[model samples]
Target chain A: MAPKYKLTYFPIMGLAEPIRFILSYGKIEFEDNRFESDKWPSIKESMPFGQVPVLEIDGKKICQTIAICRYLAKQVGLAGDNDWENLQIDMAADTVTDIRTKIVSPNYETDEEKKQKKKAEVINETLPFLLPRLDNLVKQNGGYLANGKLSWADLYFVALIDLLKFMIGFDITKDYSNLSALKNKVLEIPAIKEWVAKRPKTER
Target chain B: MAPKYKLTYFPIMGLAEPIRFILSYGKIEFEDNRFESDKWPSIKESMPFGQVPVLEIDGKKICQTIAICRYLAKQVGLAGDNDWENLQIDMAADTVTDIRTKIVSPNYETDEEKKQKKKAEVINETLPFLLPRLDNLVKQNGGYLANGKLSWADLYFVALIDLLKFMIGFDITKDYSNLSALKNKVLEIPAIKEWVAKRPKTER
Candidate 1:
C-alpha cells in the first residue's frame, strides 16, 4: 500500500511548495492541509517542535520542510544515485536556502527601519553577490541546479522563485536568463503546470 | 583502497566539530587542514560557495556543514537505518542548528549596540523558550537525540554545546540535566575524548 501523506502549513507557497511540487511531479496524492494564522496557536502544540510544514506520513508526523522535501524527492526518483551525488544536490539545495533566507528576511523584519535597510541591501548587494553565482552554477550544470540533471534541487529552486518574487516584490531572476529558463521549464511540466493553475490563490 | 579524506576550515570547532566527531568515531583518518584568517582571501575563491567547513573525499570537495556531517554520519554508522529515521534525525539536527544560529549570531554582529541587545535576547528569551523542549527530548530519547539510540544528531548537539558556551559566555546546559548528561556521554567516548584532547586549540 502507498503510504498516505499529509502536509501541514500556511496556504502560501513559502516553504512547503517544494514538497508539493515534488508530489505533483511524482503524481503522488497527498492531503495539502493548510491553515490560517488564527488557528496556528491551537495547532502549535500537536506539532513535534511547535513549527509548521509538518508532514504526516503513514501514521507518523515528521517536522522540517527540507527534511520532508528530501524524503519525498527520494520516493519520486529526484534524488541522486549515490552519497557523493546526493552531497552535491544537498549543497545546491542548501545554497538556495541560504539565498532564500537572506532575500526573505526583510519581509519578516518587524522593525520598519531595519526592513527598509535590509530590503535595499538584499536588492543591491545580496542579490548581486548570490544570483550571479547561482546563475553560473545553472549554466555550468547545463540548465539544472545541481548534479547536471533535473534533481530535487531544481524543483526546490523553482518552488522558491515564486515565493522569493512575492516577498521581495520583484522578479529578481528576470536578469538571470538561465534561472528564468529553468523556472519556465519546471513550470511547463504537465503535472506542475496543472497544479499551479488549479492551486488556491493566496495573499503571500 | 580507502579514499583520502581532507577537511578545510579554520582551526576552530565552530561547525566542523560534528564531522570531526563522526570521522574520529569511525576511525577514518582525514587531513585537518586549518588556515589562518590572513590567508583566507586568496583561499576563499577556491572554496565552493566561499564557505569553510568543506570536506574533500579523494580530492572532491563537498560543501555545507550539515550536508557534510550527514554524509560522514552515514559512513560512521551514526545515521538512521531507514528514510523515516533519517527524517527524524535531520529534524533534530536542524532544530539544533536553529538554536545554534540564534545563540551564535550576537558574536558575529558588527554593531556593539545591536550585539548586546541580541545577546541578551538569546540568553533570556531564546534559551528559556527552547532549552526545556530540547531537554525533554533528550530525556525522552534516553540521552540520545532523534532516535532511541545514539545518532549523529547527538554528536552534533554535543559538539555544538562547547561552541555555544564559548560564544554565550556561560555554560547554558548546566540547568538542563538531560542535555548536560548527553554532552558528558559524547565527550566521554574514547575516540571523541582523544580527538578533543589533541585537536587544535583556538579562541573561538
Candidate 2:
C-alpha cells in the first residue's frame, strides 16, 4: 500500500515549494494543506517545532523543510547514487539555503528603514558575491546543480528563485545564463509544469 | 586505503568541532588544521563559499559545516538506519542549526548596544523557548537526540553546546536537565573522551 503524505504550510510558496516540487516530480499524491496566514498564530503552538512545511508520512509528522525534501528525494530516486554524491547534492542545496537566509533576514526586520537597508545590502553585496559562484557551479556541473544528472537540489534552486525574485523585487538571474537555463530545465519537467499550473497563487 | 581527511578552520572550535567529534567517535584519523584569524583574509578567497569548517576528503574540499558533518556522519556510521530515520536525524540537526544561527548572528553586529540587546534576546527569549523543547526531545528519545541511539545529531549537539556557552558567556544547559544528561552521555563515549583529552583548548 502507498504511504499517505500530507504537507502543512501557509498558502504561500516559501519553504514548502521544494517539497511540493519533489512530490510533483515523483507523481506522488499528497495533501498540500495550506492554511491562511491569520490561522497560523492559532495553529503555531500545536506544530511539532512551531514551524511549517511539516510532512506527515503515514501519519508520522516530520519537521524541517530540507529534511522533508531529502526524504522525498530518496523516495523518488532523485538523491545521489552514492553517499559521496549525496554529500555533493547536499552541499549544493545548503549553498542555496545560505542565499535564502540572507535574503529573508531583511524581510523579518521589524524596522522598515533597517529592513530596506538590509535588503539593499543583500541585493547589492550578498547576491553579487554568491550568485555568480552558484552559476559557475551549475555551469561546471553540466547544467545540474550538483552532478550531471538531476537531483532535488535543482528543484530546490528553481523553486527558491521565484521567492527570491519576489522578495527582492528584481530579476536575480538576468545575468546568470546557467541559472536561467537551469530554471528553465526544472520548469520544463512535465510534473513540475503541471504543479505550477495548478498550484495555488499567492502574493509571496 | 582509507581516505585522507583534513579539516580547515580558525583556531577556535565553533562549527568544525561537530565534524571533529564525528570523526573522533568513529576512531578515524584526521589532520585538524587550525589557522590563526589574522591569516584568514589571504586564505578567504581560496575557500569554497568563503567560509571555514571546510572538510577536505582525499584532497576534495567540501563547503558548509552541516554538509561536511553530514558527510562525515555517513563515513563514521553515525547516520540513520534508513531514509525515514535519516530524515529524523536531519530534522534534529537542522533544529540545532537554527538555534545556533540565532545565537551567532549577534556576534557579528557592529554596534555594541545592538549586539548586547540581541545577545540578551537570544538568552532570554530564544534559549528559553528552544532549549526546553530540545530537552523534551532528548527525554522522549531516551537520552539521545534522535532514534534512541547515538546518531550524529547527538555528537553535533554536545560539540556545539561548548561553542554556544562561550558565545553567550553562560552555561546554556543549566536549566535543561535532560540536555545536560544528553551531553554527559555524549561526553562519556570512549572515543569522544579521548578526543577531548588531546584536543586544542581555545576560547571559541
Clash pairs of candidate 1? none
Alpha-carbon runs more than 4 Å astray in model 2 = none
Best by DockQ: 2
DockQ of each: 0.68, 0.81
Local error of candidate 2 at residue A152 (angstroms): 0.4
lDDT of 1 at A33: 96
Model 1 chain A weakest 10-residue run by lDDT: A104-113
Candidate 1, residues B114-176: lDDT per residue as tens digits? 789889998988888788888988887877787788999988888877788888988778999
- Candidate 2 per-residue lDDT, tens place, A21-90, comes to 9999999999999898899977777777778888888998888999888989998989999988899999
Those runs of model 1 whose alpha carbons end farther than 4 Å from true positions after fitting are A107-111, B107-114
